[model samples]
Target chain A: MATPRPSGSGKRPTITEVARRAGVSTGTVSRHLNGGHWVSPDSAKAIARAIRETGYVANSTARRLRTGRSGTVAFVIDEPPASFFEDPTFESLVIEVGQALAARDQSMVLLLAGDEDSAKRAENFLLTSGVDGAVTASAQPQHHLFERIQAAGIPLVNVGSPAGLEDRVAFVAADDREGARMMARHLLERGARRLAVIAGPAHTPGGSLRPEAFADAVRDAGRTGGAGGTGAADGPEGADGSVAEGAAARIVTVRHGDYSERSGEDCAAEILAEHPDVEAIFAANDRMARGAIAALRAAGRAVPEDVLVGGFDDSAGAVAEDPPLTTVRQDFRRIAVELVDALGKQIDGGVRANVVVPVQLVVRDSTSPARP
Target chain B: MATPRPSGSGKRPTITEVARRAGVSTGTVSRHLNGGHWVSPDSAKAIARAIRETGYVANSTARRLRTGRSGTVAFVIDEPPASFFEDPTFESLVIEVGQALAARDQSMVLLLAGDEDSAKRAENFLLTSGVDGAVTASAQPQHHLFERIQAAGIPLVNVGSPAGLEDRVAFVAADDREGARMMARHLLERGARRLAVIAGPAHTPGGSLRPEAFADAVRDAGRTGGAGGTGAADGPEGADGSVAEGAAARIVTVRHGDYSERSGEDCAAEILAEHPDVEAIFAANDRMARGAIAALRAAGRAVPEDVLVGGFDDSAGAVAEDPPLTTVRQDFRRIAVELVDALGKQIDGGVRANVVVPVQLVVRDSTSPARP
Candidate 1:
């Protein structure tokens, strides 16, 4: 039986050795490993085997010397499959953050923590990967990754509220609940009495707070003196679709989506089925709102005439859509600026807890006055 | 400064000493220097001062041990501002490539090389930064950064065909000319005449080859070929738009764009003004095609009912548009796969050359019979 070689023994195998063993030149070895070019399958397998057998590691030190800064950051997120970059709100935010980090001579290393495996991978990457720091973004409160990040001594700046780990972490977030209230007020000001909501997943902060706040605003505006179970509703009181909030305040129907276009369409179809008389629809995010518009159009409803539509996260597509969408702008760039700033402070040993970035209502043609 | 101390002569300036000098804790010093979190303005200045005074240079060895990979693949593009990620065809391709790299445990470092200043910055980053390799996407051949990247000894891959350096460097590209020719032939077989082209920028290979091959195909079809010139002409041939081979070929009119939506809109508008009787429109890319559709719609023209439209690059938006687009689908993923394979080989000491991925036409609802 062959004895296993002692760890770290002998001269560290050079890249050239692997090249020679694979019957290829050093350039082939470099190109193959770097993944910018291709090698034959036979040679590729041979190269992989040689790398493992010879315990060969590229002189990453020499490589780093050429470049001044280590170019890696933990990109943390917890979302459903295909929903990672598909959600217009998260997509715009991530892209903006990516642009910001790239400008500052940093690279966004994606650490997808959508599941247990991904979370574990993220934790390990955070601890061992040569990332300068981490910019963590999550719709849900991923306490596990947050705690691990803090424990690993990796400077973490959450893109949204850190929830249970708020005291320990630095974060940049939008006032989602406040933005929802603002949207509700706009609809009311426009005299949209028959309101409905297309909410996001209940687990996410954006999904939970936006609908809740909108309901609160509606109830407060009506001043019907608190009906049965009105204050204890899951999302918003009006969203329950029951005369639960009393007949004085037109009850709003609610349907939930996982922040997906298809879900938005399905939810919109359901809402319309239940409440065909609904005059206004406010989706939790822009993608869903866009879907609602499509569904409304499909159902032979004229936007802002028979049915006004609004969404959150003023994504690029929202502005470009047929009628232009009325949505809330989450100020992603500001969040990015604040997160970087907070991370810098935390890195310097100052604890600045939970910071909030402002959001605003952006009304476009998708919304208009309710039918007289 | 009173007595210029020899750098590194005293006790190696540990982070602890720097923190003490800065009047902050070691954790704060770590965060400030690493740029992970925001430090308060005053504390950050103090840490900066301590770092400068101590002449502390974070060694590359420690960094290498932490990050298994060197850093990032510096990504450079020579497109315009809005064209960066707004053009669906190019943007989708870029995103696909980025995703591929991420899957392989690599991070992409963006180097915006749009202007001379940004070009210089890109050159400097590639030369001095910690990127293990660099990838140039849709870059113009004359850019300073493109030249610098070629000279840099690090591993390099060009995403598209870079005109002058094609033979000397490795690249992954789509078969643009072949695809264009295929589309032109398909249109002719469907009995279409009076064709107009919305061409992309002439400086790049994708833009240049597509129109050139398309014209060649029209001439080969034995139609009177008159559409081969760069400037506008009354008729492609002498009197009637006829093929040089007497096969009845005629270049209706050609308009140029920088491959952006606005540029596409302008070009399409110009083409329509020149030839309202045109039966078919072939846009070099999907973005231009979408713009052409919008222009056509605004002019009260019906698609496939009045004018047939064909576009390149089967992007997601292309399929999702009002009328699903008929397009030439460039095999971007296959090119990415090949690029990765080739890069792995080249890194391991293999010779590399230019590679071209195939493209195919996807027939959809956009194209129809010419208005009789």
Candidate 2:
């Protein structure tokens, strides 16, 4: 952990000292230090010795004044600090972004702006542009940090949907609606004729977008969702598939959780009590899905056997579950690449743009193909 | 995140221009910008307007030149970027450290020096004293990053045992030896004597220190560990406890893992194969402990019913296990506080020193007392 951290001090040796000790002009010392360009070999050696003897570490501020680039980027988390550990989505994005930045020979400075005060501090640092650009993950629209970042005017990339300011700020988002639709279709293909869902908080885009998209797909299959409807098969899906007549899957019930595992468990227990015959369950995020799976196990139901389960965000928890989750995978790697690329382009005078990364459906044991 | 990332422009307005526009000396303009000290009200107003008209954002580098302080600290991770998400200890420390620094109105710059190139970049940063100090976590002895930081000569605080350089750098470490000893004693008190251990990598301090301490404590109980002999108990613990005279525990086998859940499972599986009669297993870290629990369950060896399980590091994974883990808890909050506090002292001309934070054993269902 003892990495050399660049810093500043009051009584540091000046370049004048190095020039004096080397018996060369200050201009020669500056040139030699910058790149040894135009400096004789003997002068370079003397300057090196003088630098070592004077303990003359070049001042970072002075260096920046000459080069005008800090060679760093800040990865800001715009939530309470608790989310940094609690939410696996942030974790995935962080690791990806850090590695990508490192691949470009850049350091990623992680800043937690979970509160207004911390946001102010972050604003102070970012306003100085000590870092080249910023990438914000898990930030909500109209967040104060947003306006502050806009004020700083550095190249910015938002990981999720940026509600507004579409033309002003660059954003990279997963196709949440499309992913949810794919999950719903997969559930139906597994012969799940009755369904339940644990959606995210209503205030979030995922909260509204995913369940709505899922219900829309179910409806497109000639199924009615939200309010329970057991009788049906009038949907178009029976046209080409093996679905029996009037066997269109129905959304028997729906509940909302705060995207936490405990919330998922609570919502699942409620759905089980209210819609006991529900054939399959879907959660907007993997955390809630894992919780739902645990609840089902505790209630004596076997996943993919007695009750099928599916989740979104194929995060770390998705694989850890006993019956690995059949979840939608957000393209975090692509997002990171796009974010860094977008920043580079913006720095190179390119226009700010939006990119919607596709989501993928990964079928695992949690939602096995054959349903009882 | 379209944050206001302060950046330098190719044609940024100069202070001399501002001074000329304000009809004042450049020194007067500087005074007005710094604090408005010794500047008349009219001159101050003119300077402010001129700055706005010029669209000048103060250069961070120039500001640093004036202040001689960056008001930031580096939290160096001496491993690859992958560990940022995989290892919960680092996660916990990051959150705690970031919050602590926020409380002090100082920014924490996260830098990864997992390889030689990244290490070089990190050294370049710290050498300039861009940050006031550095705090490194999860580092090993003789790491190249260490010597680089020393060459930089800024205040530093290593978050674990520094291995060498005791006189040069300050450090704060958890009492790993005492914590391991406590876990061994707890398992014995819970009436299990046939113990097995899943230790960390041999190259790490935790890898060697914890197992040795646990073995020492077992010996204090008059028990032999590592390469088992289960015939009899010649231990003194029977004198004061419920254990029968011949029931002292022995470590049937010991295995190593890379502190990964997968590795933990592998080690536990190997131990289970060689020591089927073992009553308990202890892992050097929480991740490994969680993996061991999973393996034990997979083998139909019920936790605390057929075999008790113990793990070091009461991390997030500890609680997520079905039978929540009983493990050692390192006080990351205290460590963070001490790190920041120590840096403050060092910056204020205080002597470097070491501090060992005590560890505590958190009892939970995994190592429940009525062991079979």
Candidate 3:
């Protein structure tokens, strides 16, 4: 690949020097450093010995400089910094992705661009800095950030479907709609005919899909109620809670929260005031579900005895409570591993990939059969 | 200042070109970009205009390459990754430090060097990679990671005192000893004397200092009892619960946990078994306090009614409890701000500094006086 020279005179060693000492071509030496796919075991051994004897660390530095790549990937969390850490999903993603990158001998840098100025600066850094790729979590729906990253010729992967850019950007997602549907069906199967749902904000990927998916599951379960209400309405409005005399499960109401425990508590309180006979509740995330449990307790109703509570994201809170929460657990470890793989493929092979990791429903005592 | 050329061909502009366009020294333009400490407003405006007119963006890249500094800092967490996130303190530090770095136009990369292999790779990366500085959290009591960083001329700041290296390395810590002392006094004044302490691992900075401080305070409060037992012995062993009949107050026992709720539950259950007459507990952190409360509840000892519980770190679980936990609150925001400031100072001025942020005692119902 290059002109070879005899071992240098007491100077810094080069790849060529190692190649000469190893009795192999520079390409073979290079291949060994880049994981020796074709080099024979003997050649690999020779290359290793030559590198050690020569104290050679220049290949990593020179290759990076020649290509202007930093050997680092950015893990972008575009949500508010404080709020992002409050959700265990994001933290788990960070840990998993960090571990995966470490295993591949790559480094992951975290970029929290929650503020607009920070976001703008981050975009500039990605465009001009030496980072080879980026993976984004909690990417907003209608932002130009993704487009800018795409236009800059940087390989980008999103944790969830990026709204309108679903087909364009590679993503790995947990099926939120399917998870919500499972929770709704579980509650119904447990003899819950009057149901209430506490969904996340309507603008987010899960917020937009989870509540409606739950209502649809209820309807599909043979609910014979008034026309289904709008996602925004309360009680018999957006979701018809009033059903025919002998009808099956029906959505009594649907409320929205900001994916926080406090918001869930408030929403649950309002739902209780409106639908006293509501038999079960499904919260979009574990935090909100915990809030709903607090509200129910305040109303003197025992969990799984008077009302069954279900949550999503099987976070720490789900297990911290007595009679642990029944929730959907997104396989974040798999998602994280897949995210790293997808980005690496895009960087090395120019292949764009989308992966959807399945979710699991964890049943706990929160939805245990009510005491007779 | 170097000799500057007049504007010539319509090619990419340089710092010299910008200086010529602005009719100022090249140093003045450089100074303006580095905060314009001595540059006049007129010169700054002229430099800005010249940058716009010349389309100058090479200043950032050239300055970086010329100095061989990446202008990036690493936030190093030396604890096990999964366990690190379970504690809110570490998450808060990450958020605060990230925000602080953003304000100064510096990027903070997270380095989760938990596993041995990952830790070695991280050390190599820090030594060879272009990161300017690093701030570490949850650093084990015994490790050479800091020494190596210092030896390689990399600026390192520990979130807490680095054990025996306190005099040699820069650190920012909350007042763990004073915080523990305050909690001891609070419990003593609350009328209950038979107390227990759930401390963190004895090897950590806080773990070593807190419980011993509490025990020392108890002894100083003029306890009339058998020579206080060792920290390792329960009840009459390490701490004498059998006070000379009618003593002012005495430590019933001291137990150590790994600062986890589950550990707290295990320790508390064991304490209750060995020292059933224990009237109060001071858990080193909120998670442990919650665990202690859980154990107490399981044993039919109502919190505050039968046994008072105090926790350090006013974490989320503190408020989530029905009787919100009364605990110590570390000023993490202040610590984080100070951490960034210290590292930046070290990087820019080569001045190592150790700073300590204060802590506060938040009185919640967990430590409330027994209701009549």
Predicted structure with the largest lDDT when compared to the true one:
2
Candidate 3 per-residue lDDT, tens place, B209-251, comes to 7788887877776454422222212223212223334455678
Q: lDDT score, residue A108, model 1?
A: 53
Ranking by lDDT: 2, 3, 1
Worst 10 contiguous positions by lDDT, candidate 3 chain B: B232-241
lDDT of 2 by residue, A107-126 (tens): 67777777756665665566
> TM-score order of candidates, best first?
2, 3, 1
The candidate scoring highest on TM-score is 2
TM-score, per-candidate, Cα-based: 0.68, 0.74, 0.71
The TM-score that candidate 2 achieves is 0.74
lDDT of 3 at A152: 45
What are the Cα lDDT values of the candidates? 0.64, 0.72, 0.71
Candidates 2 and 3: which is better by TM-score? 2
Residue-pair clash count for candidate 3: 5
Q: What TM-scores result for chain A when each predicted structure is judged separately against the true chain A?
A: 0.71, 0.76, 0.76
lDDT of 2 at B90: 86
